[model samples]
Target: MTPADLGRPRTPSAAREQITTDSRTERFRARIKMLGSLSCQLSRASDLDELFRAVYSELAGVLELNAFVLGQYDEANQVVHVVRQVHSGTELPGGSFPVGNGLTSEVIRTRQARLIRQWSIDGPRWQVGYATEAEGFAQPESGVTVPVVSDQRVVGVLSVQSYRAHAYDEDDLLLLEATAEQVSGALRNLRRSERLDSQLQRRVTELETILASMADALLIVDASGRIVSLNRAAREVLCIDDSAILFGKPLSHVQWREWPPAARAVADALEPIIEALGRGEALREVEAELRADGRRVLSFSCAPIHDEAGAPFGGVIVFRDTTGKREMELIKNEVLWMASHDLRTPVTAIKGYTQLLERRLTKGQATPELVANFVGVLRGQSDYLVGLLNLLLDYSRLEAGRFELEPKRIDLVALVNDVVASVQAMSEGYRVTLQTPPVIEGDWDAVRLEQVLHNLLTNAAKYSPAHGLIDVRIEADEQSATVRVADQGVGLAKSELGQVFKRFYRVEGTRRLEGTGLGLYICQRIITASGGRIWAESSGPGHGSEFCFTVPRYSRQIEQRCPRGACCWPSPACWEQVSPRLRSRRAQA
Candidate 1:
């Protein structure tokens, strides 16, 4: 053979086979290059829509396309979610379908590739769902469906179909399978990223909710002392409406002079804590006071935040207003002092008088007049001691939730008049006037009502100037009765009005006066337990004060006593008069 003939196959059949082999090799190389390019495109895709477009474009280059479908398999529900569907180069609406008797379902069920060469014979065995049938077009004759698997599990399916018979060969099937394998990895990564993003967003929302709801002021700072975040309470404590002015600013560089006086004082107090944070030190329960707005006390804690490796990354601080607590402490101390002194004075007087009487009797200087005078003095001291002791005992019982009321029908107007007369007899300079409807009866504890009136009148007498006026008035409505006791006394300040009802709380101006500070508190407790409300009102100091309370005219206990079909009165209007027993007793008198 010649040199040129040596390069060629010897027989005609061999030469033709060689040519076919060369063509196959070139097609294989082109498919490999296409797969590499597709992988690169998928990696660069920013979203699912972009990834779907890339996949469709790459697959179209190598396959006869009449319809293309991409779906994610939901194994738990035994269904596929079609993410993208195209028919005749036109996009179609995508939806989900059950894993029924269909070619796509078979591929997903077997986790393998399916090749249908001719629709008339093979399509009937594995029928297509309504999702696959395109209206106004001939039925598909051939198709290829492959499972997109990852981690030994099928996650999705990729499919292509053609209207012509024998359209796809074994080579096309292999190419589609390889493409599905690459897509499996990319799809897995995308879903994983989406799950992580959803979890992170949920965590951030929960954190924001907690911070907003906190009552204590919270502040977070980075390692460089730059402010990272502060809660609503922190902004309120700093006395700033907008917190944007403080974000990303170093704590030490804040303009204290530009802040309000109260905020400036708070900032000054934080300086030492800031320095400690810089030194990586933790501080707890550090208290400071600001006198700029009356008096405000703050208790704060600071700690260094650390990473998982125990390296310091930043710091956090939480503070709360403690002015009420500090005031309570002061009030407690003052109450203790007053209790001790008041108890001792009565005891000392009794002791001294007893000693004096014993000495006089031993010296044979006792006379009836002298003994009588001494007895009177001793009796007065003993009564005073008994009253103080009772006050303390009542307070303790109320605090322990043991104080109870005995309710009965009573004339409120008569009770008030009696209390006024008794107080007037004891008080030399005060004149009390009553303006109330005659015989307005209510269901209340008579003894407790008397006690309330006695305490209020005595308080007015104690705090009033000589000849001060004490006015008592009563009014009634369908549901309740209101009583108001007003006195021209050393009235309470606006701030003290709310505080006066607290146990062991006395107005600062009234500290020098004689009291255990429990009378008003006990009054409030009694009124509240009777299904009522009590409050004090005053127009600042030295302007007179009024204490008003309301009680239900007919309490539950009273209703239980006078049930339906067995009552003394026909209607609630009958409560405007005294009870029959009282009326009869008055008539006899």
Candidate 2:
């Protein structure tokens, strides 16, 4: 060796070997640099398509630029989806194909890299042809195919082909394989992100559906007390038709005083509840009322919403209408008050008369006339008490759905005359005149019918002026009989017409009258259960009122003509024959 040749090979073979080693070292360093560049590109990609495009751009620098195919393997279906394909440096449409004896499938099946150096001989053995080539492209003489693996599983395949034979060597195969492995990790992450995004979108849709369908008013506020969202019911309760004006605005910004009287009343009631929620205090079932229109009661609940860290983020408020419940409670209190007063008055009268009688008898100063008079007074008071108790019993039975009726054939005119005579005998200064058909027979409970008539006549006499004229009119069709009782009395207001049939409900002006408010309710129940209906009508207060009801008219043969499986009383045909008004009322009952 010469002194200048210290770093040079001594033999000819050694010199060639040293040159090859240096070249291989340089190529390895270049491949490592390419890999680093690819990693950076993959990380910057926002989605799967972008990541795949990045992989293709990176691979183009190191491989033959003739043909390329990037495919995702479907293991269950035994197919490969060509997601990206290029031929002669031009992009081609992608497609899918069944797994077969192709270079791509071999790489996927073996999970190994494949290098085909020649086409004519090696391609025939592997059955590689147009089936494996990109559409409108010639078969390649040389190619490298590699499996993309992640978590020790083969997920896809990557291939690059060249028209010239012996284009790809072992080094090219290794480079392609490394690139595929890097792509596998990126593909997995992109798919996972896509799944998460889809799930989050679905959850948002479900939450919106639930909020829209909720019956209670729901309001969501941000940390600064600004309205974030609200449900349909919340908008209705607040009387806000266009919610855009309120969203992102503070709850205090609502000009409650400018709203309609009823809505303003409700908003005023909710002011304190919202204030408490702003203070981060939870409240439940706080009640409020709106008295501007009719009485309406509402319940409110509020809670502070917190993040996973338990720090307060916002609050939610729910409002539920409880008007019906509060009204029921008021009616119950009224009934108890009226019942006590009515019972106590009669009992007090009876007790006073008995005490006087006892004293007079003890002193031997009671005469026959005096004794008889005392007995009569006691009996009248007792009868009143019994009648009151019976009214309560009937109401109880009706409420329990246990009230029953016994139907019998009877003359409608005679029944009305009998009820009118009885009512006139009991109440003075009330002239009740009846205009009816001479003979209209119907299947009905005679006792219950009389009770209904007596209640109507007494109610008319109690509310009418002195010597008021009450007209009882009866009409009949081929199917049913109707009776109408009208009186010149302090008529009910329009709002009170529908409520008059409800138990324990009384008109405001008639509260001072002697009634338990169950007469009309009982009458309604009896008529309704007998396949009939009752209703009240009036122009307005002081214009007089009318009560009308109808009963189906059925002969013995018609009553027995019910269908085999029918459970209803007078057969479907009988009901169909009645007036439309009667059918509508029965349906409502």
Candidate 3:
């Protein structure tokens, strides 16, 4: 009171101006404080949802926010998604709405702050639709809606309301506009993070899918030698049916699993890969094969895999079944040795005979008859050599998988009669008899089949005693035509029956016979390749053996399989006119 008395009196306008100035300064400080706190809050918000919550929290700090809708604007789609909504003293639901629907739309379209002294969450005055329209939610007495602008464009809308009329003033509008920039920053950051997360997930799925489909049985181990991953083929190759047993097991325990004989043999062979892990070494294509009793049964390889920094982490173990390859190699080696020795014998004999003939002529001891006899012997040896060469050529063609057939229709009866006649002329002792239907016919390779028949007949004569008889039967049915060559010769043992068709195999006593062991093998190949099977039947040794085979038979009623060079048929289209029943029969044949 004493200080007031001593002070000089001023005009009312001056006092009023001073009070106004103080009030403005206080508001400016408060505004600065609110904006600063909002920036800090947004910086710490984790995602769009948290930032939305932060925006409303900041608004509550500076003004009365009774109700609000925080929406993301999609201008291209002309829609507003009310991503978050909060209200006091009213029930209102948030969702998508058309851009031009209400007060929220007004702020988005004009890109300016909007004020409505009185507003409803529903009805004609409130244009934007909400989920609470059917719930009869109350209206806001007053509100302010503003665009949340960032980077010179509006990204979304921020609206606040109060239950009291004119609850939001100019000061509230200014504060909300300033705080919206922080919200905008958060939304963009969150969207970027989500996109990155989605891309990462997709890449992981692609990698897993690729690893699962690999053809080779693959196994992956970690730095600690723990089994971490395996493919479907691994389960098959290892003969394991359960994944739980394999996924977390150690590489050291692979041999202990109940592996199949083949897999166990591989695990035993792959010791090199296991030892490399302990030595901190990397291996690539470490080829290995597993064998039992000195015979290769399986083959496989191992290679190390590296991590991101090129550090050794694991290895890939791959396996394969190589039984067929091993068998083929053994057969090929045997064939080469036998062929060389067999071919050399004939050549060596011919050389010796020529030398003797030359010496006899020079010594004046050569008679004309002796020279003629020597020439005849040479010719016979040459013919035998030619036959061997031909057999070898046929074997080569069949082994190389390139044998071809020229099929034609023929009277199998005529073929049997002609072969028997030829055999009778060549050999004096063996009497060959033929039994057949008068006109049994079929599709067959004439030249090759004739060779097959000739081989059977000659072998029969060669193995039979002098004056032995050979019975030949040619028979046909709806399905196939069969040829039986029964010889009264030294028959085969039970074991010899199966071995007779093997390459380089001959009966025990028949080794001295004038025939290479390749004849029956070649005949088997030809007969089997022509869609027939050849087999031998016998009681026991010295009794006799019957060699029988079958070739497919088709109806000769409408279609006859004609020869390649000469067609005995009237037209090539004769097959097209066959009856349906015959067509089905031929197709089955």
Candidate 4:
């Protein structure tokens, strides 16, 4: 129990314990400083490969290592490229190295640090480049490799070798791991930035393709009012062949330079609209007329387009040629006005004469027979003038798109009978007859339907030779009713049938017959507006012609209740009773 035995098994004193703790703390502090320095260097590098190179070179100096190799991962190629190499006081050729084999693969797969104290002890397991292996043996084959990982996924591996066995202690391993983590984070950031740049490029290409495909001229201007882009249509419209005209040119300069006055006005007014659009305002549209070279008249419209944040980016203008349409409108207005004036003069004259005769008769200043004869002539002329005015009004209403029809159930037989009676009074030398079915009920506008039948009958009377027959017929079944008007006049020539229904169209060969040339056109318009179609057929000139139209039929009971009574158009085959031989032949056919 002397002092030696009582000294607690000869353990070191507090001074020695304090020294050991201080050494360990110093080691930890050094490792931390190394990590911070390497991280700073790697972070400053711009891309993944550059970061890997910086991290490898900086760590080699901080650790005082002899030789090192950095293999940066290429995810697409599934290979690692030797991004950096350092051999203290030595030279080693640098190149890409495979990751599928040896020490690098083991570290990446396990995400762990590996150390070889001596190459002789485990040289067979350390397969690297022949140049690297040769350099390793010169340094006693002592080395350490640490996996660079981010988010628990190993991205690359960092390897450093020393010239002495067990040259790297546990503190060195800890420092290498910290540095690898920093390098991994920098690499991930670099990759993300690259992907964003690629996406932005693709979006720009897509926008260009869309603008090029647009049919209207497109021009894009920057906030500074300079032209940034223009589409193919713009180039053609501006008559500029080179793309140099668009880029960096002020929008106002290009818009006004050598442009027409109307185009200039449109461009000037559109600038503010584009500015408003940049403020996220609603797009503005403006129309202007442009006539540059007299080749055509153009109607132009400009509209503002906006950016993603709702700022006005630029404007789009469209041009449409309207020269022909405007000219046609002017011609139509003049012709109708003149025709109306011509009609008024005749009407005034007839009214004055008729009123004079009526006054004389009222005063008993004329004989009964003489008064009767004069009155008859006056009435006929007045009626003729009234008919002309009615025709003109109908044409105007139809052309103006304002006509409204009131349709009701009509008797096809009664309609034809009324039309024939009117035609007979107008032309005593012309014989008119109606051959029809028992009865037919159809939906029709009474006034318009009557006009159609009257026009057909009047035309037949005027064109037929003296005592010639004009046949009218009504044919019907459950679905439809057809009215046929056949004239034993000079039939329409083959070339005339197609043009008969056109406005102001008349057969020149039939000039002997007087007409306004609007009769057939009016007839066609009336029949079509009443939910029916009309057409004419002729065998040849002088062989006679037939006009037919079909209307949807109502039941016979409806005809009985109709206020206008039963009216009908005889069916063509109804003539069988009038012509036994023709009926027999038609039956045989």
Candidate 5:
């Protein structure tokens, strides 16, 4: 009575307790293994779609399921794509659905799992958004829909359905909810990777665009001396064509040197770049200047580029075309030299001569012939100095846009004769010839035009040798009259023709010539202001030159209306009859 009665109820209760403890332990271990398996599967997924499919296939072993579909929400488009679906019994709809209408939508909206057992075909909840014809589903079904939530927000939904009602209970819902969390994390991570990749691609495109649009040359070379990147400006400066690129080509390769035309200067410019690559370390900036053409000057710089750790990776070259700036600098230097030498020499000479004459006269050592000869010498030096000063002053006035013209009508042919007569009277040992019609005329500044002719005659006479014949030709058309002054003198180089009008520009090796460089420049300015264009024609040095300029013909109406005896050119209306009667006076005396 003692053993049987005492152990009966206690023994049965203990057995049940141990059984419950074993069941809980087994379920816990199984849940842990399932989670580990799911994690392993998701880790191998490269993209979101692959993750979706992985979760779809992996969750089947962990849960009681008949039909499954994983839906991802596109909140932007308000649509959901059924990324993965697996079923053999009840047929579901195709691959997309509107977000706010289905059982899956309810879970996303609430961030909760749904256990809908009574799937009445005509029920209000099921009938409203049902795709019966498209889904081909037999009703009276049961299912559980769990939202895949991340950071407390639903990103998508995972669903499983069964053909019988009351197919799932609270424990099944618990397992599905726990599995939904892992799925959400995997999908989130995949999405983040995709967004990062997209941003990287966008940045790469922007960099390429920026490099292509740059105006200055930029070149990037690798540590191996191979060209990696070159901008549009680099290609243009190097004269590389569009049919090919410099990429992956070594800088020292013989063909690459020729690629840039290496024309004596470009070759020198690339030398530093080649050396920088060979050094394999950061290099100081090396500069190069190139004068390929007479007009444009190119400047280049090469330097080694280093990474954040101060380790040298490769090198870069930057090129700037500074033609205008170099030309301006050359002009400035020339002006400075002229001022220091030409201007100072004449002033100093005049001062010295004056001092010497004053000293001799004070000592009473001067004779009458000596006084006259000294006076002539003094006068000549004074004139020369004054001419130099006048050139500088006139050039500055013209540059500052202050030179003015006083207009009057005059016979240009008469002005030429006057210039030739005056120049010949002043300078000897040079013969002058005139070939012109007597009647050609224009509305011009008579004094200034005469001065212009005199300057040209004087310039020709100064450059010519003894007994050299200076030919002056005058021609006219309806719109303008032209004069040509030809000389037997040292001709200008072809390059000098365009530059002769620039202030302080002189031919190479001609600094020995006695004169300021402003003569031709002033002549051009005067001619341009008088409504004309002027230029010089020369084959080359030692051949000879012809200086020519044209002045526009005066309107007949304006000339005819002018008051007589005041100032006016002989209007065509007045000259038409007389021009035919006057014979050409060609003189070579």
Candidate 6:
């Protein structure tokens, strides 16, 4: 018997019921198979379009549908258009659905499934050409649409059309609903993944902007000793031509070999810190030097980078350019050495000549005029030599960090008077006078202060024209004391004022004037060391000049004593060990 003959014929109601059960079962099995295949396709899909095409094709093939279309909403264009399509017989016309225009629109608008059993009624009624074409091919007399919903809103619709009358049943609706659920879950996941990707891109852009603005060179290396990130300054300093070559590539391959010795020392020192970090110790304030492209760069620091769990991931190095400052220090040292040598040679010769004269004269071998002449030359050269020696000693002490103060109470008025008198006594050519305040007390190095006053007085005298009046003044207050030495000498040039206190710096116009060029510089150091400051002022060239300095007040009382006949001891070594009783009696009387 044929298969159709062997099967028993059924009544209309029984056939209808049997067909409904079988159709429902078939749809349920098809959806299950579609879900299984689609899951694999979803995992393999690299992009949205690929996933959409796979989902659409798999659903259409498994369901045995007449046509299938996947629509994507064009937010910018305000339209819903098909991205993937499968047609069995008649071709779909451009697969597009306008907003609120067709059966697709009705399903989207209501967010509900719509079923149609007869194509002639459902297709023309809904004005959906693609569905009508599918309906005609399959002779579908009944159909159903299931809305794919995600995030409480309908994203799309999945429609299945049939040829037989009343073909769809409750089971078919349940199976289509399950398929819609899978598609909705995929859409939600796609949206989440896209948002995460966008956020990551924004964070990277923000970090890049911040790094570009830094002044010092900053480089970040990864666990494998490869360059991961570099600031704009690092790129410019190292001459990086390709970003790709730098990132993930070993730092040694870049310009590390060409760095200066100091920079290399910094790099070598950092290796230990990196090693320590690798061993799980946190490194902070680690200093390193990096040399790049033949330039000397002084890097100030290195620090380890930490991961989310506070594990050491890599290191960040920060460095600055110190070439200019280092070079300046070297030049200053060399210049100071040359100046000391030049000044010491002349001073030493004068000291030898004066000592010889002093020895011979003490032996009483010379007549009065000859003794007087030799004594005069000896005094003159001795003073010149002493001035040069004092300046050199003071400057050297400052440089060597050996300068210190032995503070004492002193009379500003008496000191000025003594300094002026001594300066006047040294020469008959220039007239010197002291303008005084009665008293002042200060904690100061008295000898250094005296030397400063003596140097200023000598400069004033030497630069003044014959018989020019040099005025010295002492002004005192609770907070400070100012001593001013005004001379009617050729004033300093405007261009020379700024450099007057620099060691060995002198005005070109003052070459004819006798000086070692260090007197003013030494004076500044001594004044500053004493918690004071000094400055010079001039009206103009050839007008005259005034030099001033202020020393801090001692806030202490001065000891009661009578004016001394002479405060300048002939020799410091002998004076230091004098009897206190005699010294006090001499000071009082």
Report the Cα RMSD per candidate: 8.6, 6.6, 8.1, 14.8, 11.3, 16.4
lDDT of 1 by residue, 45-88 (tens): 76677777888898888779988899999989998999888887
| Residue pairs whose backbone atoms clash in candidate 6 | 117-141, 117-142, 139-163, 140-162, 140-163, 141-163, 259-291, 263-289, 266-289
Show the lowest summed lDDT stretch of 10 residues, model 6: 557-566
In TM-score terms, candidate 4 sits at 0.46
TM per prediction: 0.70, 0.75, 0.69, 0.46, 0.64, 0.48
lDDT of 1: 0.81
lDDT of model number 2: 0.81
| lDDT computed for candidate 3 | 0.73
Clashing pairs in 5: 409-569
Q: How much is 581 displaced in model 3, in angstroms? A: 31
Candidate 3 versus the native: TM-score? 0.69
Q: Model 5: which ten-residue window has the lowest total lDDT?
A: 580-589
lDDT of each: 0.81, 0.81, 0.73, 0.68, 0.71, 0.67
Candidate 5 local Cα displacement, residue 53, angstroms: 3.7
Best by lDDT: 1
lDDT of 5 at 129: 26
Local accuracy of candidate 3 as per-residue lDDT tens digits, 220-289: 7666667777777777766666644766666447555455676666656655665575355755555555
Candidate 5 lDDT tens digits, 1-589 = 3776675665778779879999878876886788788889887788866776677666666666667778777767767787766665343544877876667776777777887765774222742222345566554377778888777766778877766777766766787787788888888778887788889889989988988988878878877777888888877776777777557876456364455344445645676665765586444434455546454566666677777997767888777777777777887677677867887776787788778888889999888887888788778778877877777787776655455555556888888888898899889889888999867877777876876787789988877778898999999987789999999888889889989887766777676877667888888777765557789998888877889998776734333443221121122222222221131210110
Off-target runs (Cα >4 Å) in candidate 6 are 1-27, 36-47, 72-78, 81-98, 124-145, 159-174, 242-244, 253-273, 288-313, 320-589
Q: Cα deviation in Å at residue 276, candidate 4?
A: 8.0
lDDT of 2 by residue, 343-396 (tens): 998899999999999999999999999999999889889988998998988876
Kindly indicate the candidate among 1 and 2 with the higher lDDT: 1
True-vs-predicted CA distance for residue 27, candidate 5, Å: 6.1
